[model samples]
Target chain A: MDIIIKDLCKSYGENTVLDSLNAVIGKGKITCLMGPSGEGKTTLMNILMGIEKADSGAVENMPQNKSAVFQEDRLCESFSAFTNVKIANDSLADDTIISHLEQVGLGDAVYQQVSTLSGGQKRRVALVRALLAEKDILFLDEPFKGLDEDTKKIVTGYLLNNTADTTVVMVTHDIDEASALGADVLYLKDGKITL
Target chain B: MKNKSKIEKTIAVAAALLLWQLASVIIGEEVLLVSPFKVLVRLSELIFEKEFYSAVAFSFIRITFGFVLAVAVGIIFATAAYRWHWAETMLWPYMSVIKATPVASFIILCLIWLNSSSLPVFISFLMALPIIYTNMLAGFKSTDTKLLQMADIFRFSFKKKLVYIYLPNIKPYFISACSVALGLTWKAGIAAEIIGIPDGSMGEMLYNAKLYLATADLFSWTVTIVCVSILFDKLFMKLINTMFKRLEDL
Candidate 1:
């Protein structure tokens, strides 16, 4: 089912973020929310993911089970890469997780703590976790922020291949990222959305 | 570097013992101060006797039980206080009172309310509860909001939240509290035993030695308590560190 946003509006103290915006997020497709800084690209995703509330609007038909790669690599610092992913789906087999970690070029650091991983490596771990989790909708807020050119290409390819059939909404300032994922671009500006 | 530190430690200890021996010789009064050599001799003799082990073991069991019970209660209270604002407010006065009240006063008052045998355990528990509770509560409060939000987004179960999020945050607090509380419980427990004069206790033996002016016996028992307390502290800390090590490795 597609997610429908109807007159979604939000304001913080005095600054209006979403001024009666509306959009429809198609199911099983990649859509990227692109905008300048502080334009509520993340705010809209947070509302849809139920992490934040809108002042006066309705988000309809959002999936019950949601997964996200937050702007920050919110991986548990002391836990292993395997454990961080396992926390999302403990029922998943360890070998499967190893395979996924291998795909992301983190095979050596599989059993190492996330805190020990570099920024790009930690981002890959968070990406792998969300990508492997059992969720209907996936949210990505600058998920690949810190990778170099080569690593970003490999990760972008992996993400595209893996999430081809999943509903993914990503927020990125890099329009090239939207192009690489073959994702539909929605520009958020002035509390309004332009697709 | 390790060998250097070891040599430094040995030299420091030797200097301390030499000063202690010199002080004993200068005093020249057996009633007031027992020499280190004589205390060592008395300790060796006491170890050969059955009553020494029995007394030491008994006190160890009661005090350890009290410390463990207090840890359990402290965790529960800290969790409750973290979850509910009113619970924190309600416990504020009680925590303040327990922290401020003297151990001797509590032991004497508890002696009136409880059996002499259980007095040490109760006192140890009372002394340890506030420290553990306060530290663990601070840990809970300091948990990262971002990680919590990640947990919420992933819909993590309580078990996962605890293992991945809460345990890591609380570990330092828990270990520090245990270190401090372990030493305190031993001191407070022995004090309670000395005052309550429970039969077949190390504290009772110390009281008898004091009453009879047997400074050697007093020094021997004091040395024994120090050894036992240090030994237990080392073992407990090693176990805790190893457990966390395994947790991290996992």
Candidate 2:
């Protein structure tokens, strides 16, 4: 089922972030939300993911099982990369988690603490954690922000392969990322979705 | 740099000891201030007595038990207060009273209610509770909201959330609380014992030494208490660190 947002509104004191916004996030497809800074792209995602309450809005068909790579890595810094991913879904086999980390070029650092990993490496760990979780929808907030070009290509490929049949709402400023993922591009401007 | 600091600490200790020796010699009265050498000799003699072992064991068990009990109860109370505002409100007055009231007052009041033998245990627990509760509560409040939101999205179970998020976040606070509470508990515990004069206790030994005006024995027992307290503090901290290390590794 698709997630439909109707008349979504959010405000902080006198500043309004999302005002009367409406959009449909398609089920089992990739959707990229793009916007200038402070346009409430993240606010929209947060509302849809039920992390934030909209001032006035209705979000329909919100998935019961959802996963997210938040704007920050939000990982357990003392835990290994493998443990961080494994914690998302304990039912997943050890080998499956190892293979996913290996795909992202983190096989050697799987057992190393996330604090020891570089920014790009931490991002990959967060991405892998979200991808491996048992969820109907995946939310990626600037998931590829810190990756180098070559690593980005590998990570994007891994994301595409894993999310082929999963609903994905990605927030990114890079249009090339949207095009590479073949996502339905939606521009968030003035708290409303366009195109 | 590390070796330099070690040498510095050694020098400071030696200078302090020399000053103590000089003061004792100038005083020249064992009844007033026993020299360090005389105190050491008294300690060596006390160790040969079976009563010394019993007294050490008696005080050690009660004080340590009190501290351990306080830690467990404090953590539980802190977690409760964290989860529920009502719990915090209910506990506020008690914690404040415990923090503000004099230890002697509590000891005297508790003497009217509890057995003398249990006095140290109660007093230590009372003294340590507020420190642990306040520090652990601060820790809980300081947990990252971002990680908690992530845990929610991932639908982490309570057990998983505790191990992966809460425990690690509260570790530094827990260690800190333990460090402060350990010293406070030992001091308060022994003070309680001295007031109550429980049989077969280090406090009773100290009381007897005072009664006989054996200043050397008094100094020796004082040193023993300091040694035991420091030893326990170090071992407990080591255990806590190892436990956290194992948790992180897992």
TM-score for chain B of each model, two decimals: 0.97, 0.98
Every prediction's TM-score for the first chain? 0.98, 0.98
**Cα lDDT of model 1 by residue, B1-250, tens digit:** 9999999999999999999999999999988988999999998999999999999998999999999999999999999999999999999999999999999899989989998889889999999999999999999999998889999999998877887899999999999999999999999999999999989999999999999999999999998999999999999899988987777665
- Candidate 1 ranges with C-alpha deviation above 4 Å: B246-250
**Tens digit of lDDT per residue, candidate 1, span A60-132?**
9988889999999999999889999988987899999999999889999999978889999999999999998
**Residue A171 accuracy (lDDT) in model 2:** 99
> Would you list the clashing residue pairs of candidate 1?
none
Q: List the residue pairs that clash in candidate 2.
A: none
For every model shown, the clashing-pair count is 0, 0
C-alpha lDDT of candidate 1 relative to the true structure = 0.93
